[model samples]
Target: MGIFEFVANNIYYTVPIPVYVAVLVVLLCQVFRRIFISRRPSIMESTPLAHKTSDLSHYILKSDSCPALQVTPDTTYSWRDKPQEVPREIKPGKYFLTMNIRKLDPNDYIIFDERFLSEYRERQAIIENVGPGKIFVADPSDGGALDLCEETLVVTVDFLVTRYPSMFRKTERGVFCIDAGEEYDLVTRPWSRHPLEITCLLSGEDHILIRCCDDGTLRVAAVGLVYSLNIDWRSFIGKELGSIHKDAHVPFYESALQKSVDRYFQKLPPDKLISRANWLTQVGPELRNDNFPDKYLELVSTLPGNTITPETIVNDLYIRVERQAMRKLPSTNGVVFKFRVYATNIWDLEQEEGIPRRFADHIRGLPEPILRQKHCLECADCILKAMDFMAEQQEKEKFMNSYD
Candidate 1:
């Protein structure tokens, strides 16, 4: 009352006493909330740095009964959370024409989702059948490659434990994977295999470790890239960025992206974790298709019954998105291009809330180079017609609901 009386008398602009009291109450409530509430850190704040794994050779064991361990990025994901992130990344009315790189949340550096067990088995089968040498290629000449392999092992194990505590318990014996039903003593390799090979089986995710050359170009020193985007991983093992992109048939690298990418790598600090997403369409449902130029040619075939019409495009077309994150290793001075592939049928696009029309528009808006890069040029007409039809139906439904 005294405070209100003082304010009322002192201020030239007279405010009501109740208004003053209400403002005071709101300010007090905000103060209390700030004192009690726990908030996520602001963007400018540093991500919680991962703790290095201790020897743990004789550390006291924590009980696994009720999950004494905790997990972060605790937003639960499942098979239903199909990773066709195109719809989410596409702004409400915005479309991207080029690489839309963004700062990645460190917690989201690796996503161990519902597909863990299935993908683990699938990647393992590839190893047993196709041979590990084909998938996990390492440079015997580069010492940094071995350093990257070891440090990657440590980082991956630490991540699995920290991000998924209950499932991956780190102890004296190494990591105990609940889903894999076995323990991996990768802490001290048994001399049977390399650390990169062990990490290949650790999760479904893949990586290519990049080492900087004295000439300021990034070189692919090693890779455990199994889920193929039609690139021959073997050919890329020793290639520099230019040669790799030339083999990749990567569009606009020399003209548009090479200089910027080179500069980014040189300027990148070990402390920054960044990510970007890229996507394209394929003819088949396979997630690991290494068949390249031929696959693009197959889409344009005019052969009887083989040509994809608007109707058949739904079942035959598959969309694959690679969500990639990169971090420059402080210890190894190598950059880890960590990524995972998520594939879905074209039918899934129509079912997504903001996909059909927006995606169709995005396709229509794509420049020729991007269209060729995405392999959408040959089938663009059929894809646009089909999605535009769906968009029309959606509009009709909205029109019909206006009376209600």
Candidate 2:
């Protein structure tokens, strides 16, 4: 303990106040440097510059902005200026110009107003003619050769109206160009009194022509272009009929007569029915004629299965003849007739009543009268007439069967 105490006391004394003060001063300098001297801004603290500027020059210079004056590079002319002094006057050389409006931001459009910008001065005359294989245009008098460089080539008003529908709309009698910028109503004068027909010739872009016609038939050429082929209905019908005859299973004469009658009836309007008076006038004598018996038989044999009896045959014939007459008659006074005949054979059997009398009674009981007085004799008389005809046919068939 004595030795440690002695050594501690000596060191405390030897390490003087000056040495402690120097070490404290050195520490203070380091603290001061950290607080005030060493702090500085980093490289990342710099200000940023803008990449783009807001420019509105395009929006300011619009067609609508200055309505009276045309803002062109060569010359600006106001609408109030004399028409003759305006640069818009048609000159001799063909020219086209592109016009841009600020409101339509994305696109600029072109217009061909003057055919020649230099030679014609103001008034231009156009002479047009159709040649053998080309179209030629010149000035009628000799002011200057017509120039079409700036002009829309061979374009008709119709073509322009069709191609650019939004640009043109139809009026009551004509068409006019639409102006998106101003209210100027612009309509092109027709080149001639007649309508102009524009067609695209076989050759490419260079081969368009304008043909003028008085009648409004210019659209026909366009229709022909769209539909190049034609169809004939009569030719098709003939071919179909020939095919039917070629494939027929029945005799040609019989099949033809049946088909003709069927077709004729099919063509009749539904409201009309054949009648007895018309049947007798048109086809009854033909059926009874000796020379036409074969034809008559051919026609009759083609009747439907239910029409075997003489009464049914006569009814069907009357229906067909009435239909034909109604189709041929004018609307004014066409008489429609109705008739019926029924018969039964009274061979050596119990004669309760003749079959014809029973059939006639059935006809008479129907809701509608089968025959009016003018169209038929007495009902008994009509029934007897049919009976006589059937009896004759039956006898002939019997005689033939006996001989065979």
Candidate 3:
């Protein structure tokens, strides 16, 4: 029989067609799933802080691993027994006050120093992620904004030259050039390049340049960020600081208080600088993008209980702390909000005397509404697991140390 005729006549030939179709369907399903998952921005993999691994059992835990355990609910736990004040209430206007900010420390102003190897790696990650789009976008209608950009650039470059002399150099033509090994031609504007260079040459901290609008509003004009965590910078470009906080669930942006915040930025003296630190617990220590409510909902909705467990929580979890500073450029009158991200492992918190208890107590004290806003329902199981783990580790260490 001819080959085609034989196959056509054979019943087994029919099986291959159906099997091929089945395989194609399965592949299509997988492709769609992948596309859906990847549509959202991904967390860029970057090197974490130095000393993250220096003492794993201590207060500095660092690892690049995802959650591996399924989250389990612990109903028998009691957090009231410890009673420590932490996770402070989002008291309105607490950090934005006009208290006399001390004479600025150059080190405090610059969070990430390029002298560290890990910070340099992070800078590369940011440059890679902040591609194509101008990191500094000027309000097109504001003709004077370009002047402000140039002025901000000069102020920043001068600050870098004066504060970190070794990291910067001036060309014979007096053009300030960063000492980064490679050029970043993609970062076009001088203001953008200045912060871009700072990000690439330094480590740890991210920079945001907020220029004062003639209308008394402070606009976020530029940013050098690689460790965005959950923030989407594109949305905030050229937006007023008060308008930026408009959607925030917190009461800090109440109309009267927002006016004060705006006033504070406007009247902030060039000689003074202020700083604050905020803390939270995260499931992973990666310093890149973290899909907050949307991605968190997607993951938890599909596989809520299976997404995390105590082991995974403890293994992958981190204490996320943001050290933020606000200062005004003497020349441009522009403001800079510099943020340094510090992630410590839950296991490490056990080393400290009262940090774990205090943090947990604060978490417990948070009102249900705020907790809901923070998406605690999805991550509550894992958070509870971390708290319990920290407590157990704390007691174990204390018991062990008593003999010494």
Residue range 60-132, candidate 2, lDDT tens digits:
1211322211222212322223222111111112222211101211010112222213111211121122221
Q: Give candidate 1 regions above 4 Å deviation.
A: 1-88, 91-98, 188-190, 229-231, 291-314, 399-403
Preferred candidate (TM-score higher): 2 or 3 = 3
Q: How big is the RMSD of model 1?
A: 13.7
Q: lDDT by residue for model 1 over 55-92, one digit each (tens)?
A: 32222133222122123624233433554243235433
Q: What is the C-alpha lDDT of each candidate?
A: 0.67, 0.26, 0.53
Give the Cα-based TM-score of candidate 3 against the true structure.
Answer: 0.61
Against the true structure, candidate 2 reaches a TM-score of 0.14
- Across 1-404, the per-residue lDDT of candidate 3 in tens digits comes to 99788877985755667887899999999999989876742222111222121111111112221121112222332223323222222233223422223344543455333234455665566656665243434455544444444444444444443444444433432233344453322122222343344432433456677887778878877665666554557677777777776766554445446777777889987767677666555666676647443244556657846664334444556666667777776545777776777666667776666566666665666655455545454555666666667777777888999999
lDDT, model 1, position 279: 76
Q: In candidate 2, where is summed lDDT lowest over 10 consecutive residues? A: 219-228
Model 2 has an lDDT value of: 0.26
The lDDT, on a scale of 0 to 1, for candidate 3 is 0.53
Give the winner by TM-score.
Answer: 1
Please rank every candidate by lDDT, starting with the best: 1, 3, 2
| Model 2 spans with C-alpha error above 4 angstroms | 1-368, 377-379, 382-386, 395-399
